[model samples]
Target: MIAVILMLSRGSHSRSHKLKSRALICSVLLWMSTAVMTRSSSTSDLKSKISGVEELLEEFRKQLQQDESGSREDEEDGDRCISGFKAAEERIIRASASIEQGAAFLSAPQRVFSWRDCAHACCSHPHCTAAIIQEDLKQPDDSLRCYLFNCTYRGRSVCSFSFQPGFSTYSRVNNSSRPHEPGRGSTATDSPSLDEPPRSDAGQDLVVQLPTDWAVLDGRDSTDDHDIIHYEWALVKGDPSVKMKVTHPGLLKLSGLREGIYTFELTVTDTSGQKSSDNVSVSVLAPAPNAEGQKLFVYIFLDYF
Candidate 1:
């Protein structure tokens, strides 16, 4: 009976050892599964963060492109508006000068910073043909009073100069090929026939690459019924150091041009003493960099990123 009890105790001890081994194996498997699930969750979060960064970069690039496009459009519109009109010579008119009839005032005088600003204001109106800018000593700049005019009455062009002191005028050039109509109530035999003022053609605007220091201006296309006795060329606005010379009749030579916009005026006076003027602009651009230098710059820029 003692031998039988010892065998039973050995069997019970063997069963307890097997149960402990099975429990250890199950605990290892549970730990491995938990580790795999944690690793998978970390990878998913990393991928989600990467995707969000890419989306943000794309949105930033699109916003930059939109801003660049808008800026380009605004620049183009400003250039187009400013280049449409021509400025006349500034002259002082005393009380002896008579004001022309049929001058239609467009609106009340507007305060502006410069004559260019006044011209821009006039360009905003559809029927505005001319602008008069009056200088005011109280203002910081010469552009103080701006007067807009239609310069047309009924179907005829009856606009004439009234030249007031401290005032300058700018008129829109007629780009159409049509001729101007005759003046009001003037008969054929009125001593000096009321002829149309000479048309001054300052030629098309020009753009030149730099290192070029000279340019030619031709006003040979200016037209008048009578002989145009005088042709005058003046630098309206630009670098004041530039030199000008009348190389021939209705032709001018400009030298020492810099990388900036230069405006020139061409005035033609006919035998009847009637004068007309037109403006032309020349834009000088800086030279482009060498191709090798550009490529090197691009490479350096990319490596920095």
Candidate 2:
């Protein structure tokens, strides 16, 4: 009986040990699963934050690129303006040459078309085709043939308004009160705006007022002996006027100039001739055909920011 009882007790002990081992194994697997889930959650959160930062950086970079592009476009506009001036100069030269060619036709008989006299004749009639190359006409009977043109001399004077041709007479054009139009001179249609400083236009820029007519800076303040020029400006771009008088009479004066966008720089000079400068910009409303030719000159009050 004792031997049987001892064997039964040993079997019960073995069953208890097996049950404990199974519980320990289950607990270890559950712990490892919890750790893996937490790690995955943390990694996902980190990735999300990194993506947000990248997106913000991309936005900043795009803004920077846009700014650079705008700068390049402004430079291109300046170049185009200069090119327009050059083209206009060429057209004047051609028109002057055509005048000479027409006058040469007039002097076929006596054949002495001085540029001065011929130019005068060509400009007499509003729609005259040719000029009287020579004025020493024998009579009106030969005057018709005197104005005949046949491109003979194509010299450098063809484009030269400065050419000194013998002697001549200048007459009123088209019976108008205005004097004979002088040969076209170079026209500068540049308008400079002097309102807000250039540093103000960052995101959405506001319109700036320009000068009305011509504004001359006599160096010093109109009243004071102070020579330093400081640009303390405000935006009057929405108004229309040639001259804008501010409450501060001794400050600044705006004038009407050509029409166009103008970048104005205030050149500050001391008695020692030391110089400093501040920059601002304004846009004058003008047509696309003449935008490059438009000039706006604005003045800013100095001594304030």
Which candidate number has the best lDDT? 1
| TM-score of every candidate relative to the true structure | 0.45, 0.24
- Displacement of residue 156 (Cα, Å) in model 2 is 26
- Each prediction's total of clashing residue pairs, residues at least 3 apart in sequence or on different chains, is 0, 21
Off by over 4 Å in 2: 1-13, 82-305
Model 1 segments beyond 4 Å from truth?
A: 1-22, 91-100, 108-111, 140-143, 154-156, 162-165, 175-305
* Candidate 2 lDDT by residue in tens digits, 70-144: 888755544432222111111111234654343222233333344433443443333233232333456554332
Please give the lDDT score at residue 4 for candidate 1.
44
TM-score of structure candidate 2: 0.24
C-alpha lDDT values of all predictions: 0.71, 0.38
Any idea what lDDT model 2 has?
Answer: 0.38
C-alpha positional error of residue 7 in candidate 2 after TM-score superposition, expressed in Å: 26
Q: Choose the strongest candidate by TM-score.
A: 1
Among all windows of ten consecutive residues in candidate 1, which has the lowest summed lDDT?
175-184
- Candidate 1 lands at a TM-score of 0.45
